[model samples]
Target chain A: MLERIRIVLIGTSHPGNIGGVARAMHNMGLADLALVAPRCEVITQDSISRASGADHLLHSTQVFATIEEAVADCTLAVGASARSRTLPWPMLTPRELADRLPSECQAPSARVALVFGREDSGLTNAELQRCHAHVHIPTNADFSSLNLAAAVQVLAYECRMAWLSQTDNQQPASDPGDTVRPVTVLEADDELASHAALERYFEHLERVLVAIEFHDPDKPRQLMARLRRLYLRARPEQMEMNILRGILSATEKAAQRKHHHE
Target chain B: MLERIRIVLIGTSHPGNIGGVARAMHNMGLADLALVAPRCEVITQDSISRASGADHLLHSTQVFATIEEAVADCTLAVGASARSRTLPWPMLTPRELADRLPSECQAPSARVALVFGREDSGLTNAELQRCHAHVHIPTNADFSSLNLAAAVQVLAYECRMAWLSQTDNQQPASDPGDTVRPVTVLEADDELASHAALERYFEHLERVLVAIEFHDPDKPRQLMARLRRLYLRARPEQMEMNILRGILSATEKAAQRKHHHE
Candidate 1:
């Protein structure tokens, strides 16, 4: 999956940034690198020295005349932009981009390209529109400026994580199925409810509560917002969501029966 | 919150890498950078050029003779390592480390230090043990080598994210009330159970389980371990923990009654 992903830099101004990006890519096991008419010398001494031991990437890097030519073969092209544009495009956080990469590159011939722009000014409006999606690495709004290579390193790291997760899912651990494992710290299970499902659940909950006269819908205070915060904080798993919904349904039925009796 | 994070690079051999780290730290809004017994000159032209525009960090950077002196005032010290060790220690991913920093740095006098090791060899065993926790940046297992500055950038980015999340919570969007707002993305609420409280709960849990005869005290095979993973993954809030403990106490009482009946 990493091999199928190409890192494309457009009009990079500094050789050191190019070298730094190469080192960052190699650190995360990404080898495919494409430069689109860089302003600085790609084979300069500073680049080689900055690459540390990853000069091999510099040696084999492909330089292209245009962004379209550079990413012509890629099925999915993602442009990384730091500043917001007047026109809104499909934007994703770095993690979201990584999560979708496996399916995006599932085809044998499918390729993905992560395009970065110049240091001073990011991808032009036309260049950003050329890509299928845009990735924004959230930073301090006050100091939102991130170095080009540092941005590449972050996205590269995310890609590695996404690839590793896919591999782990495909291959189970070596230990026997029934072994009593020792206390190993584990990450949170990936079975939590999706944003869409949670949204539907919230709607159902709000409707049921309003019907039962728990809170007047027209004059709703912070009840719904507070509930949203609590559940979002919990990050409920599928089973937990089902249980909560079940409780809400039962309460709605009981409330309807009481209203009918009254 | 970022101001409290001190980045300490110990025994760095290359001046350029040191400059790169300073650049990375400043890019992510971290200003407190300390060098512990560096092998090369910090104010050289190589470092200045590598720093890009973060030369202020280079100029004001503090120097220390030993790791102990560097982090003496820090309440929490986290060491970054790419390799696993024989001695098991508390470990956190970069994201997890970031999530905890907001609360950890809330105190007026509290400080946190993120320590990096030499370029060739990472932190010594003694240094690793000295840290309150260890942070492992997940990399491709095949090629786990990361540039020193790149690692700093990743952690610094996470720190910035954490700080941003904290600030956003404190000051919400513009609106007094009565606005049909879109579903705003929010982080988990800051009411999570503290590490100390969780530790105490675990001790109480193990004792209660043993008293109930559900597991043998002499050979408690993975019960506690599995429970730890489950609870840790859940990351229960304070109220949730209280509810869990209440259930446990009720179960314990029921078991005692059964024993008395027998």
Candidate 2:
């Protein structure tokens, strides 16, 4: 899973940041490092020195002319952006992105790229649009300027956590059949709804609400945003989501009948 | 909450890593950095250069002679360790630790110190014992060696996430009275059991287990460790823990009565 993850840096301005990123990747056992048209000297002393003992990553680091070329082989490309754009793309927190990766990278030779943009400006709209999804590392809203390497470290850490969880799932059950059970169990057994399924549900929900005149699509203020926050927090199961969609469908049919009668 | 988090680095070997750590802390809005008996010079060019724009954090960084001195006033001190010790202390993943912090730091003047050990060898057994709990950043099992600064960045990110969640919770609910409700919701209403309360419960639990002869205290293999993991993961509420303790007390009384009958 770690091998399937490629860390792509776009137009990095500082040699130190390049080195810092190498160190961060090495720290989390991620070795595939790709740079997209970096402005700094990648092999400078500052980079090597900052990389600590991870200078070897710099030796084999691949440099690309563009983000597309760098992540050409990746099935899922996630762009890390801190700023909000006019058109919101599908967004995931670093942890959520990590959770979604294992299944995506299950097939042999499947690849995923975590693309990071320049330190100051970040990814351009066109660059961001090219990616499948955007990842936001939740930081202090007031002072949300994260150092490039630090951002990599946070994402890399989440990737490692996801990999560990996947490995734990694969491990054979070791507990004896008859043992003193714990007083309190941790996790519940419900499977969480997938991102794609949830997105489809949201679209269906919005259309139904508009048909019923519950929400005006033209004057939609914070309704969708608030609903997104609520559902994202809830992380409903597939069955629960199906139940919700059923309710929405019934409501839409009832509203249509009332409209015809009027 | 971020201000309450004090990042303590103990016996740091490299000046550059200290600077790197300072940079990471500042990036995540953690202003309190404390160094305990660092081996290298703190104000060196390497430290300043590595700090980048976070030199202010370095300038006002607190220096202490011992871990005890550094975290004496802190209510919660979490030690960061990659290696498992012979006696497994209370362990939390970075995320779990983050989830537990906001409430703990809600009190005015409440302080929480995140302690990191030296580069080559981590915290001494004595130093780890002093901490209330240990936080382990999930990394590649095969290559679990993380650079100190990278480790700081990961924890700081988690801390920031926790702070953000807390802030989001405090925001005014802007949704109209009537709307399409979300199918799934995430968090429960139970306030997690505090560390101090949990520790007291553990002591009582061990005594009861010994009285009932359910667990042999003489050669306790991983009983306590396993129990700690279960409870920590469960994060029982105050009422839940009280119920558990009541059950343990009842079991102990029954065991005593059976012993008398025999």
Candidate 3:
């Protein structure tokens, strides 16, 4: 994946940021750094000094005269932007981007480029159009703008994480269909009763709610709707529902004794 | 889980590693650092400087005179090691260690201790015995030795990942079974199914065994026992029981078809 990924900085003005991007990529296990029409000199001693230990990668980096040249061989392209675009290339969260990249592009021959536009203007609509996906790194909504290197760092970090998650997913699951189901489906007349058998329990619950003064004749429909929504939202599992029903039954019996005294 | 995790360095020789461990724990969303009879002077100015932004963890860190004192209040204790121990504690892969800790302890007040032994020898047998579980981080077998900070980083990372997973799990566990069943019950279900259900399935399954002549009459019980062990070890879920029943039904139909042919 690292081999396939080319981190492209398009029209970047700052030489130091280009160097910092190199360092960030190295930190995140990505090595292929690409420069697209960079406004600043990307390989001077100043840039190299800022690149630190990552100077080797900066030395071997690919410089593109145009965005097209930067992404020519790339099969999948993701454009980075803090703000929403006019056409809005499908916006992917950091987690989503991390998930999408590795699974969608596995072939070693597949070139994947992440384009970061110039610091001042960011990616143009035309540049974003060439890309398949838009990558958004969540920041404080009031102040969302991030430095070019910081943006590159976040993307690089997410890309590496996404790759790790993909590998973890591919790791042989001990059991197929092991994921837990939310609703309990019990077959009727079996030791476990199915959803159909639970209707009586629901009805009993409604009666108890009415007795508790939570439901009134004037607001029957609204109250029932609210109750149903609450119960459904809670999504009580088989055991939880059973335990709850048991509690309600006990409460009802207690209420009956009070009426008997009256 | 973040609150409970107390990273205890047992007989740590380097002050630098202690500082480094703080950084690792902070990075992995773990606080509550503990030092168990460190050889070097911890909490010094140099150590704090190495700790960078994690000084608060260092300041609040507890220094214990003995390993037992460090872990006495801990409900769950995990000893981190790269290799197998002659003395058996519940051996957990870092992943498994991560999984068990959060499930086993939910009370924010409950203590969970992660014991990392001296940088030179790792956890001693006697020291490891004090732990409830032994966690082995997956590393290259050829070069499994990891720096103290790196080991802490990996285990802390696994723990944070586990904590995040619980958050994800809590987000509407569509399965009613999970909602009501205390996590321990779910874990028990994962370990083994109810004996009664296993017996019932085996009864229906035995007829198929006879039709297939899979076992001789004299060894019928023994074969059934083996099959029981195999499934009990696998810890079949509710859906798995359905699949097993379906297979048994198919086998019965196949036998009936063969009898008609005869």
Candidate 4:
């Protein structure tokens, strides 16, 4: 499960924070790392010093052009948010995310991405919309600004915790009094849709809305964002996603036929 | 409960790590910060930068000469250790320590101190003896060395999680399905004895042991450490400590009378 966990950082300014994030990820046994349009140089003397023994991770870290490119293959992309947004989306605490990871990773192709944003501004509205969910680390209200690496450390630690719990459950229940949490094993068809699939669905949905004259692309308000939130919150299964895309395709075909008839 | 949780660092090598610790503590709503003979300067540019907005905690940080002095007033002092010891004292995962904190803090006079040792060597046996128990953060076995600030951050995050859980339990159980956990509130007489008082009892016990010829202080192998581990594990209540003190005083008096007879 830990092997399938990917850490994605977007617009990180500090080289040292990148190093710290790598070290934090390695400390918790997470390996895959992706940087989306990093503002600062990825590896440097300061980063090496901060990384200590984990500079190998920095050397091997994959850089991407955008968040979409970074997490497109991931089944679940959860963005780390430090503030409340104008648009309320589904939110989970670090522990809650951890608790859900083991079950989410049951599918062999299911990869989970824990996305972190820039040091100062966090994920933009557009960037956050790409993720399936948001995880917030509980902090003192007066001082909630966690360093980028520190945020990764918290989430990575939770991922490791969730993995440990799953491993513990795999062991035979030694103590009768212990209440073992059942891990949800996904059937082949029940696997969640990947970020790329979801993104395609959103695009298709938007085109159909425009074709039906229900949404004005030029004057779009929060219609698209709200729809994205609803669908993302639902975390459509592979079969469910297929159903949704089929319905969308049918709508598009009908719209084209209606135009031809006119 | 968080107010009662003091973070004590013993011989910290880096000023920046201390600053990071202060920030982690403040972020978790823990206020008390104590440094026991730190190797580097406590306040510096590096520390301030790492601390960000939590430098106020650094300015108000308390410095002590010894681990005993730093945690003397604390009812429960838990040391943060990375490696397993040859002589195993009681060990807890960070989560377990956090889970136990709320009930431990129910006593009005009870103050819980979290002792972290040197950045390189961790808590020494003598220093570990001074704490009631040790907390080891679970890490990747292949690469278990957590950065000093990262270690503090993990524990502090757990502390915050525990505090949040307690706070949630306090709220009215509005959901019909909510299984509310009962919070254990301690009675006044059941208040645990302070570290200062425990140190005095240990001093008295040593004197009596030497007088009765049960212990040879000159050649004491692991006698004192074992005894310290035993008593610390017991965590004697105020009344229980008084009874033990009375017994020790009586033994001393009896030994003095025998010496006069000789």
Candidate 5:
């Protein structure tokens, strides 16, 4: 699904940025590049020179007169925005965007388009409205702007990761006797939120109890949240979950015994 | 065991080679690099510039006046030599040298040294004599001579691979109920006997085998040499010796059974 996605750059001003964007795409195994009314010439010798060894990507780039034409075939259009919008149309970080692509896109022909804005002023209201979703690359609050090429690199990297995850799910069976090593990739935000969501649910329960003054204000709310991060970092397997659940049951039983004695 | 094998360089000529040697050591997870009689100035701008980010190694480098003083306390010395010596000594390849170091010198006071020679002429006969063994790097016969830095890189790489194998062997021990992994240097040739003594033992074995007509002349001497190399590569343990003896007994039993049936 990530490979099927097209990255469309709108009105890019710098020839070097065009070249760099091409190089960045090539670095992350993303080859499809579309230019929408680019301010500078994309086929200049300077652009090709800056592209280094990614001349092939530059050569195969498709040019479009408008943003709509660039993403006409795209079913899911993601507008790259640096600023938060008043009416939030599901804002996603680079990590969230990565998860949304293959995991969420059920249709095979659901063409995913990552729309990059101009180097100077970002996408206008009309331009942003064309996109199905909004994606904001997390940067320093003071200087939130990122280089055009770097932005492409991050998005391309995320797309490649998401694509790899999908492909890995389709691997053939391994032999029972073969030496196996389990590799767990660290989660990038939204994947982390599933764990955080459980923590939030616990926090809500604690809040309700606290509001009713059922528990002391000085009492610590550290127990569940502490366990959450520890277990999340460990990224325990299914069998480990059973072991933890058994331990939890034993702890509950011990607490009941103390209550009965009291 | 790798920690016991101290890598000592004598009269190093190039700063880049020093840096490259440090990088090679880093790549192999070997941090010990001792410089004796360094021609190139220690920890200079040139050395630091070439070391890139591996300047920590250059920072920790210990300088000595002579190679003898540097390796005076060492129990086992393995010298890197390019040329064949008239006076024979135990010779080992980089992999063989890696297999040799780990477990034999269990005494905390015991030190094992791997001495690399000068850029122009390799270790002198006197220097080679001080070494308990000689290590010859296998290279292209047409162009066997490798750069000083490259030779260290190759040796360090082989050492690292062996070190990783040893580490992997220890990995099962991390799990309880599993028997402790033996730390014995079984795959390394025994350093107990000196070269001349081993040669005398080999001659005696050859004479005894010939007297018994154990080998046929038509088989060629190459087969025996190949078998010797294979056994040397295995660096068999005491338990493995028993296993081999058991197999020999089984073969003899089968031969006796065939004779009785005939």
Candidate 6:
């Protein structure tokens, strides 16, 4: 759905804004960019400067004579509108537009175009009418004037957010929440430290703690218990447990070496 | 709450980015802007144009000499990171940050800051350490060069949306479970370890690890990085941090005592 999403700028006055929009789109994983009769030159040094490193998007931008021609192949077209005008249109928030995209682009050929208008005067009534819905990026009422590129960033961001959520939802088995090692993000075969392994680690740790004089075997004083609680809460993976054991063994060796030297 | 949300740009080389960030913040009803050693002039012609009409934010922006100074008053500081770091820090999505804001700012004096680093290098290790958590804006992996203003726009937009949801709907807190991988469990804002405290803990840990010869300073095989990730994943409370620090001190004492005996 993200790749299917296209950013269309209509009558954009600033060529730099076009470059800005391209960078915004590329950042959010959207590739397709369409320009409909831009008032200013499409590709300029200013635009490239604003585009930063996303000049590939600027280079491959598709030019169209009209909005109709621009979104002709799109199954769904959502115009970025500041506010509703002469006719009331089915308005959606950027989030709502993102939510509707997956289903909207269910078919293989289905394409979605998110259209933006002139910097000063927004989409003309005809252009607004052509869109299936007008998606509004809720901005501060007092200063709702979002820069052309910024608007693209907001919508593209939401689109990417929704896509990420969808991607996460697909992997129920490997869901981070459900996973045993909640934090590590270890890519492969990261089993949790087994109860037996944990017990052995605790024994090794206790011996080292006593050798270091951190824990007194004569008066254990719930030290091991407290340590157990802390380590248990951490839910260390097998690899992490090995690291802990390595440290303990190193501590023991140091203590033994010093004792022998003495 | 949005006004309380400050956008801190660290070493922002481009003055126009400062203006662009100001405009983005203003669009999303955010006001506070802090600059930490900006490389270029704060207010240039390019900045004024990029900021559009939100120059008031630019004009009223606060300048800070350091990250600590910039975020001194903020109770919750979330740094915007691009990808997975070597030492895995607590990561949050924009939505996660917005969702947690209410609880985060329950205290009257609580201020939340969204920190953006230098345009090219992003946040340094030291800068990242100053943040309690890192918020990563999901971008296209291949071309993830999000312009500074656009990055601010995405985060600010999410903040606004979260505010809207909170205002419109009574219950926006829908059990913030394991949506993010690194955050094991985030308790109430008060008990969580402050960035300064976490920094101290890390310093103590490195010292002890070095003393034990578990970590080598010269050919560091990411030993400290791995340890940092493990501890950060645990999200130790203030009390736990104290306990851990005490253990480090004890270990250091034992190591020193053994060396003396030898």
Count of backbone clashes, every candidate in sequence: 0, 3, 6, 0, 0, 0
Q: Once model 3 is optimally superposed onto the true structure by TM-score, how far is the C-alpha of residue A89 displaced, in angstroms? A: 9.6
Clashing pairs in 1: none
TM-score of chain B of 5: 0.63
- For candidate 4, lDDT tens digit of each residue in B1-262? 7888889989999998998898888887889999999999988999999999899999999999998889888999988777646666567777767667788887778799988888788889888878777777767766778888898899899887777776453323321111233544544346778899999999998886777666688888666765676567656777667755764665555555555555
Model 4 preserves the real interface contacts to a fraction of: 0.25
Local accuracy of candidate 2 as per-residue lDDT tens digits, A214-240: 568889865666566445655565655
Model 4 has a DockQ score of: 0.09
| Per-residue lDDT value at A132 in model 3 | 90
Model 6: how far residue B151 lies from native, Å:
2.2
Model 3 regions lying over 4 Å from their true place: A1-105, A111-262, B87-89, B165-262
- lDDT by residue (B1-262, candidate 3, tens digit) is 6777789998888776677677666755677888988899888775685465677878888898888778766655678866544432345655456556666555444577788998779988767655555676543222344556656765665565456556454323221111122233223222222334545676787675666445456764344543443343333444455545654564455445455555
Q: List, residue by residue over B65-112, the lDDT tens digit for candidate 1.
A: 988788876757789977546444457778778767876777656678
Off by over 4 Å in 1: A141-143, A167-262, B167-262
lDDT of 3 by residue, A1-262 (tens): 7567889989988787787677667755678998888888878876775465678888898887888998998898989976666775577655567777775668867988899998778999999999998876543333344556656665665565555455453323443122111122211121343566466666876686554344456766554553444344333446445555654554444444444544
* DockQ score for candidate 3: 0.02
In model 5, where do residues sit more than 4 Å from their true spots? A104-106, A167-262, B1-262
Off by over 4 Å in 6: A1-4, A56-74, A85-87, A108-111, A124-127, A161-191, A199-229, A246-262, B1-6, B31-34, B59-82, B85-115, B123-136, B167-185, B188-190, B259-262
Decreasing DockQ order of the candidates: 6, 1, 2, 4, 3, 5
Residue B254 of model 6, lDDT score:
71
Task: Evaluate residue A41 in candidate 1 and report its C-alpha lDDT on the 0 to 100 scale.
Answer: 96
TM-score to true structure, per model? 0.64, 0.64, 0.44, 0.80, 0.36, 0.78
Off by over 4 Å in 4: A168-262, B168-188
Give the per-residue lDDT digits (tens) of candidate 6, residues A1-262.
Answer: 7778889999999988998998888877789999999898878999998888898999899999999999999999999988888888888888778788778867889999999999999899999999999987877878988999999998888887767666543324533322112222322236778989999999998888877777788897777876787687667779889889988877787788777877
For residue A219, give model 1's deviation from the true position in Å. 57
Candidate 1 CAPRI category:
incorrect
Span of ten consecutive residues with least summed lDDT in model 3 chain B: B173-182
In order, the Cα lDDT scores of the candidates are 0.75, 0.74, 0.63, 0.79, 0.59, 0.79
Measured against the true chain A, the candidates' chain A TM-scores are: 0.65, 0.64, 0.62, 0.64, 0.63, 0.73
